[model samples]
Target: MAEFIEHNLQGVDSAILAVPVALAEGIVWEDLARMVKDEKMAGNPIAGLIDKLHFEKNCMIEVVLALSAHANSQRWYELKKSQERKQGKTFTPHKKAFKLAEKKIHLQLSQV
Candidate 1:
């Protein structure tokens, strides 16, 4: 999953899932626009909802600033080195770079 994000969803179903989800369930843009025009949506529900989604999705912060290959090659190795030094444990091939990016993004969004 992490690699997919870093590399972009080339053939993943997520790319398709994001569309309707973001437009309908995620943002509810049409209803939101109606509410805003009619003054029914108080305090900007659309903006609030978008902020919430971005927070949940973690589009704000990123852990590794590189492509999938770079992340796998250099960043992962560096992370392993740090882990070895800090915790004296062997580096496990578990963490995914895209997942790390998502985590960082979520953390920053939550702070906001």
Candidate 2:
């Protein structure tokens, strides 16, 4: 999931199931919440919900949905930000760059 936030790589779907089950198996996720809080969400509003879910430790369907959505939304936000940076004038783009960037951003929009 670190790859998701920093690089916009939405690795595997297993973490959605694995995390809560790990919690039920006695894993402590305060570290995740603390790291998330410290890292900041870069503007994802629901990112804080994961911290609350960790406390409840219920693994209910809604909790699962919230966790999944939070992760997806965070990943989406990072991808969007990356697109913005790529579009900026920091460097010259090749002739096909606009077309390719648009296609990539389109894929980013479908992440959730």
TM-score of each: 0.22, 0.25
- For model 1, residues 1-112, the per-residue Cα lDDT tens digits are 2453345433223323333455656566455345434442455322222211223332212322123333434554576677778664333333465578889999999999
Instruction: List the candidate 2 regions with Cα displacement exceeding 4 Å.
Output: 1-11, 30-112
Q: Model 1 shows how many backbone clashes?
A: 2
lDDT of model 2 at position 47: 45
lDDT of 2 by residue, 14-87 (tens): 33554555567775777645544654466443343333444574442223333454565575667778988987
| Model 1 CA RMSD to the hidden true structure, in angstroms | 19.4
Each model's lDDT comes to 0.42, 0.51
Clashing pairs in 2: none
TM for candidate 2 is 0.25
